[model samples]
Target chain A: MKSLIDFGAVKIYIDCSVKLAERNINHLYPSYVLEDNTVPPDYFVSLKYGGGIRRFVRKQVLFEQDSKSHFKPVPENHAYASFEWGLNYVVSNYAQEFLTIHSGVVANNDKAVIFPAPPGSGKSTLTTYLMGLPGWRLLSDEMALMLPETSYIQPLIKPVCLKNNSIDIAKKWFPDGKFSSIASATAKGDVAHLSPPASSWQQRDRVAKAKAIIFPKYTPNKKMEIYKLDKNQGFMQLAENVINLSLQGERGFNTLTHLIENTEQFEILYSDVNEVKDFIEQDLL
Target chain B: MSKHKISSQQLFDLLADSQNALDLSDSDWVDVIRIFRSESVLARFACQLEESGVITQLPSYATKHLANAKLVAQRQVSSVRFECAEILHIAKNTCEKLYLLKGAAYCLASLPVSKGRTFSDIDLLVTKDVLAQTETSLKLHGWLSEPLSKYDEAYYREWAHEVPPMKHSGRGTVIDLHHNLYLPVSGRAPKVELFLEGAIETDGFHILRPAAMTLHAIIHLMLNDDLKHAFRDLNDLHLMMTEFSKQAFWEDLLDLAHKSGFENELFLACRYCRHFFKTSISTEYLTKLANMQNMNQSEIKLLDRFYALALSPKHYLVKRASANFAELVIITRAHLKKMPIKILLYHTAYKVYRSAVESLLGKAFFEKSNS
Candidate 1:
């Protein structure tokens, strides 16, 4: 089977098992291999070998793998697209010039800010707000691919998954934003993804050079502050956060050293997105 | 060199064709799909194979694994892709070129799309000369290395196969920086530069070719002091051999081993892979290599037993044997290195004590679970 989707000049062919009717609508041409098993309502998911199976489950679906596979009509125009979109990003990004990072990326002009923080750091919240700014693109809300070699950033324009109270916060913030049906009581607690702004999807493959590495912390009562971290300290912190630094060996070490030496680094403590965005724009821009 | 040793590209093509052509059961088909989709080149190859009528269907399993692999690859590729595009606009931008290694490299060079293999941390290899510089660069971007004891850090810098594993602060990913295929401190230090010189470069990254990589896998299993995960490494070696055997890889195997001072290990690995997976190789050629290495009957028998225990599906007996065998090898090698007699004895006693404690604790835990 052959499926073709045009990402501007790039054509992506997704070889999947089920047909997608919305192919023509979004320029997503899907050539699906017909399968005997029934398609489940919630698409099945699994981790491939060598794709970091340690972090993610090998198989995940709303239902069990052995259970009777059944199809339910996907709610038209939902927040998340087919699972194939996620797969497309994986194939297109791995082993390219980029290093897959577990962080959020949002940019204005070519100047992008990479927010690398642990969970509950409000990185996504900051990213969503940054995307709303004119001329700033939302590269990713969950993962920001850092091209350590060239200090470039790749956009994984997927839905911004919000959890717990952030869901309501996002809905109120972007009243026009679409969202996936809320999946409650997940391992990460109640979760929903803010529909990627249509523009974000259109610029999914846009590469940005990161200007600042901001470690965001959301302490509700803390005053908004953006402190410049020393270059050596920042490099050490960033190295600690990179997914494949060690795997890159000496090159990883060199690449990371060069990246840290050149880029400005900061630690942001703020609950207000507007305050954080303004501070980053003033300091970084 | 025989005509049988295939280039990496040719091997990939063969696997793609085989994946498409085989009339495999669903489970087997899934495995093929997983392999194809985990590596980007493989995925593209599979798609081409499909275009050429080499195989039918994307294989459901391919889609399943691709989803997660895709996510990880996206995270890595997007950053670099962006950097490449925006190079002119950025100031003082130094290119930190990283070569993907192991499964991570396979994702880019071989897998159909990025989603075929679920990856946690992207594994990469760079030259050792730039180790300090690279660590400094990563720190600037909010990544931090895990704190290591001075002794451990010195050990990694001085003699280990790779730098101590580094953890990402934001992503919770681990990166392992390797300077050599095996720990340099080992008694049997193979020629590292020969392997480095023979590395195949792809998409701005360098990687060990199939034969060399296979040998590295063997050395990793045998020499590493850490035995807790020996079986997992053994499984990886088994799977890699099974896949590579389909191609014309014998010549590459022989040439790599002879050049790298690892002819004996190459022979042993081939022998073991064949035993465990029923993989086929040129037996006459392997026997010739074994004879040249002067491997005695006793050594062969011992290696064969070790291989059996390593690959056995039943864990109970195999685990114990594996632990004991690993200890014996380490202790014997220490003695051979001319360590003081008292020090060697102390190390042996320590191993015995640790093994006993672990066994007792393991038994107690198992019993508790059963109860």
Candidate 2:
């Protein structure tokens, strides 16, 4: 089946076996598919989270298919609203131009901030908080797809995951903000996704040239601190943050070199989101 | 010119059924070899299949060659854990605690089969003050110390980041216990405590999480400067990316690399993964990070070429003489740096002698067969 979603100037066709349901949103066209086997009936869902969120799973299969394939279907009405959220991932990622980055992306009019952090660093929480700012757009909470040739970011514009206290913090910060179903006690701590801002969905394919690379750390009760990194050191730091520099080989290396040469780099350590926001807006902006 | 009609799907199927189909007269080993381009990738695939319980189905001859590959992969996997376990056991026995690095911790925590990556030696990190004790404990376990020339041993003990290699009697495993991640000579190395503080416990083993392991792999690849058979090393990175993606373990991986002082390696790994495995990482993040890393246009092109050549499964079977030459040069450089000049010269001479002997024996055998 074919389903078309308008992502700003680009209309993407999500062709899969799944049934599509169109919402008022510009980019999201959620869909789900059920599997039919001779033995018994089984259900699988494919979701398009925006860029490339397509994935298939059998409800009963786990760990058995690890060696054979990467896709695993979780219980529906869980994690994602429907399988369409996951299907979006597959279609978007299949495109050759976009390289999927494993990080949180938040952007304002002038620049986007990409936070590359290990677990427990509170990057997702920080990303959620940052997108709550008045003018900034939430590019993606999970991945940041950047074009290698142009260094331009295509908007994933998915839901932002906020964990534990961050969920409450987000609710308090933006009472009007929407959220999906809460998924508690996950591997990454208790998780809930903040709804994408209406404006972000409106300009889903808008590409942003990153202006700053921030390595964020959530230190409990620590005063907010931002340290500027030198070009050489920053280059190394950014290189380490990349997902597949070696696979891209020469193209990856050159792209990374160019990215480092052009952007400002810093390490941000903070406990207070409000304080971090002020620093980002007043000093960096 | 006729276009080649080999299908990847067909090759994959043939590889899957090579053992049962071995009786077919048309099923030649050359065709099997041609389907797989890189020995390393074939080796990795064979090892993975073997680990997954399909080894018995492979042709016996193919299995024998793959056994060496499996051994290498296993050794790499085991070296990490074995060294970490040995060190930890020693430290616990002696009331001194130590921290495990990268692969050692990862294998211990999650993947039992990861012990397949061939490691020449086990690597351990201990406090500088406890180096003597660690060495003594290792020796007590029947590990024979390789005689490093006096000056080199002194440098290793006093000024270098790690100790000389030691071999175990029972398993013939080698160990390279270290006090630091990078050479102290680098002037700006992160403190060992950074890794120690982040060590996680899983399945009764304390190991580096995904992040630390990714950083460790990157640091090892970047600092060695020995790209000999580096195509294999690239394969290892690809394997890690593919396996890790199954768990959706990207964020943790990136974070750990950043924390461990190898952020560049993480980006490079992600970029390489995208280029080779068709992994689902974001391009925006890759380019943004690449730009942040200062990878320019020309460097990007080179990386892509290297990735395409190194990672393609098609390259594993059809041998390229130039790649072999490049690998030889790299190996020679790495060996020469580590060995004494006289020893290096002697080894070179011995290699030549061995090659001459093999060539003479082959010629005689061929003549006999013809007669």
Candidate 3:
């Protein structure tokens, strides 16, 4: 079935062939994207796979959009995951309206905290946990979309992709939290999507002002330690996490500099969730 | 699904003059945006609307997409220049001459067609002699390539126009270093010097002259089996013909075609350029091409059956039911025209065998395709 999802600035029309893909999407998305014929989508994506003997032997799913496949095929079980990843590629390439950054975005009291971290730095894991906390909403789990020269980050609310050990940690922490079926043995092992609170989806159209930029790194058996970044160092560090700055050019550069100048930049090393929560409530709020 | 009544002719007309978008309904705009984006020519359409000062008249949603597409393409214009400079910095000592090709050439030469052009990666051309030294210099730097398997490597070394793409390790920018226009195999390669004769240096790098570049664009569109960029390539030809057309250009192109032994391709190029864009070409040249290719009216109609479908956007929203069959025919036709029958047969057999393996074991099991 072809469904059109309205994600604030972008509308994605997705058609899935496999039943698992359809089921995953229905469960993972905040609500059913009823067929809306009047509104044309910003992106048209489809998850398709071959059947017959290959279905049983070596099942794989292809993620296609814009009449081309931007990614390699993954196991059929990873159909929904493929769609998520493919959407990222589409936004970064075609939707230059949004200056996309490789970061996790969350907000409280309409103030957004940007977590710009490399892979395995626990960005998603921390984001997944924070989103489940009271009075906080998830703007995005994978990317922060900010219009050029704007301090406000547009909300692209979706399920956070938790991987490997973080998957179990999230499951243990939010026992009642909704999650999609786990896709095992992926490039990022044991991937699953954890849906944010319903309140987050309720305010999907709301844009949050840039409050602070935090770089999170997971250090086991250690308390939270915060290190402030100087404006120049902060500018370079935040700029490194921007995915489409090159495409955004001068305006994107100015936006990042303006953001770094206004916001406090910190690199926090933490293992205790409570310590991080206290710091956020004390300093950020 | 919405019923779309638009056809390939409609698309061609719109691309020929992008101002046609002004009359399009919202549903039609939807089709145009999706198809043009898929065909890698959305920026061209966006450029036309912006230039005509009619961009604001469109709905906000349509304008938003067009504006974004233009921004991306404008970014590439500068990026291409920077990438070209980086390439020269790395390989300048190893080579005496370098010619910018395709998108790089168009951008560096400041041609009209270069505006709103978007490229996947940078493509630059070096002579056959300096090809090795260029590769060695890039290798000493942080460039690496995923080696093709032995079977594919053997054929590539024998017939391919370029070496495997060398990507910079630190920068992650890809450079497709080319030595020839097509297959470098004896008796098949075109006269390289003929193109060089008209080349002009610009911004410390040489690019093919306007006429030569137009012919090369035709050759690229009409010869390559990959019709994925067919619409973009055809639009490129249209823009080039409109900008570079002159009495001398038509003469130089015909002369180059005959001497290069590609008059048949020249005729096809001319006919299709006229068919798609209604581009102005002299009746004299048309008659010359018809006589040169011995192209009967029926043959032209028959060729149009394939090119018309093959050249249209390959999106499900716009594609006809028989588009795949037309595409297959074009690919087969391209192979037959580009190679000898014996080599073509061998190539087909190898491809069939490889596909069978891929079907059973999955693709990328044996080789990570350079693309």
Candidate 4:
């Protein structure tokens, strides 16, 4: 039960003994090229049921890096989530080559629109909406991998984590979109994962130059409003939202400045998905 | 001495000769990167490779990691400078000569060991007579003492060489203040004055001279409790040995060790450095130190096994079977050397009890224990 998943910039070898892990791998990483397990990977991760007798009795699955326990254990049913998080953890910490951002991204014609926001800011929900649009494609739901040297945002196509009320909204909006079984009473309060369309997965390796940097805020019953942002302020905001900004240090600062200078920056306040979509189509281009 | 493991030797060779790194496979590069990152020597490796201009010859993927590491290291150097400045400001009014030790000393001295190596806490040494005043000065400057149990506090106050670590209330930088080189409870206590005799002053602060500094680094490595960061410390020794390998430096180092009654520690350091990193120590002084220390070949062979395994990088990706066992032996020996049999018994009992209570109570106790 070992599989090598090549995620363009990084590759991981996952060893799991559970069906949930396999299902998630198939559903989320549809375009990942499978390789022989013997091929050395950047990280050798294991998602398995173990954590002494108590954990075993409770049917918990722990994520391990290089056979050593890492992070905390989750229930066996959430093995996929643990594996996903473990991969994200390794990338955020070890992917020093990229300035990892906490953002959702959508691309059109290889031009990326990065939506950097804090939690509960409708980042993923907006990304899901943009991804559903005819001409737009999902680049990432979280973790915008910005290459410092190229100043290009690379795509990492994994399941978009839908949380709380958004999960229902996503299901209602995209009836055909694949959704994982609802993980109830989770840390993020009833989380579900939405698998991006197959076309996005197929283009996962496509790296795109950032065209727009949008910080989105969701407000109920509010009209869609877009505000232009100062380049220096946008740089500060991106730096603050990055996961490994300090790891890249000055180079990261320079890369971010370049990204801000080249890209159109905006702060979008929108409640309706259709109105936001119209604004992006009409004004963002 | 036990021969350095092939992988460890290969790592050193690649570090010493970046040309060798260019020949490595992607898989080998990954292992090297993981090991270097694990031991906090990625920056050191990147510095050497980039200096040699071989990093440009490496695959783009491999070079990216190196470039990123170098960037991170550059920022760390800035942080170290900032921390040092703050400490110097705190000790500005104090009359006691503030001597930077370990990583801080290396940075202050602009030694090769400082390049790309991770800086932890600020270590400052003062004369024993001025230790209390130094502590008070640090506290007055916003360094808060880390709370420890009564027994632990007493252990540090009476037996340890340094005060309990203090954290800056504002910046959260930890600082370890020492009045001596070795613990009083450790059978051998080197005279701090002997070390200060060869001190080098820069700006308002001081660092040990090359010979004394190298000796201190070796002694510090020998007295450590675990295999954690042993490779990094060994690399420090190797860098020091390589940089200050003058005949006069070695003679002065041996003389200082002899004067301080740490000849055995020096002997062990040299032997292990030679065995592990293939550090270039002249045979004349090497043989001389070995003779002066006077340990049998069999004893050296036995200790060599543990030191070799312990000094090698212990990254999970390439962890050796003997690593954990070697670390256990070294930790036990270090504990024995750090405390007398009476205190050791009580300390062991208390630790076991605390662990039991922590395990029984689970998360709450775990948080409390860590806090």
Candidate 2 chain A lowest-lDDT run of ten: A34-43
Best by DockQ: 3
Task: Highest TM-score: give the candidate number.
Answer: 3
lDDT of 1 by residue, A1-285 (tens): 323433321233333322222232233221221221222211223211111221133212211111111222122222123243344444333333345566888888877888889989998788877787688888877666666567777776555777889888888878877666665564466666665566666666678787889999998977798789998889888877777664455556777776777789999888778888778777678
Each model's lDDT comes to 0.55, 0.56, 0.81, 0.80
Q: With candidate 4 superimposed using the best TM-score fit, by how many Å does residue A130's alpha carbon deviate from the native? A: 1.4
TM-score of 2: 0.41
**Model 3: residues with Cα > 4 Å off, grouped in runs:** A32-38, B142-145, B184-188, B359-371
Tell me the tens digit of each residue's lDDT in model 2 across B117-148.
Answer: 44445566777788778778888987877776
lDDT of 4 by residue, B214-293 (tens): 88888788877755788889889989999998888988998999998888789999887787667887778778987898
**Winner of 1 and 2 under lDDT:** 2
Q: What is the lDDT of residue A108 in candidate 2?
A: 87
lDDT of 4 by residue, A50-156 (tens): 53353435556668886566576676667776677778888787677788889999988888899999999999899998898787888888888998855588887
Error of 1 at A117 (Å): 0.6
Give candidate 4 misplaced runs (Cα > 4 Å).
A17-23, A31-40, A48-53, A57-79, A149-151, A181-187, A243-250, B1-6, B129-133, B136-151, B168-172, B352-365, B368-371
DockQ values, each candidate: 0.02, 0.01, 0.40, 0.29
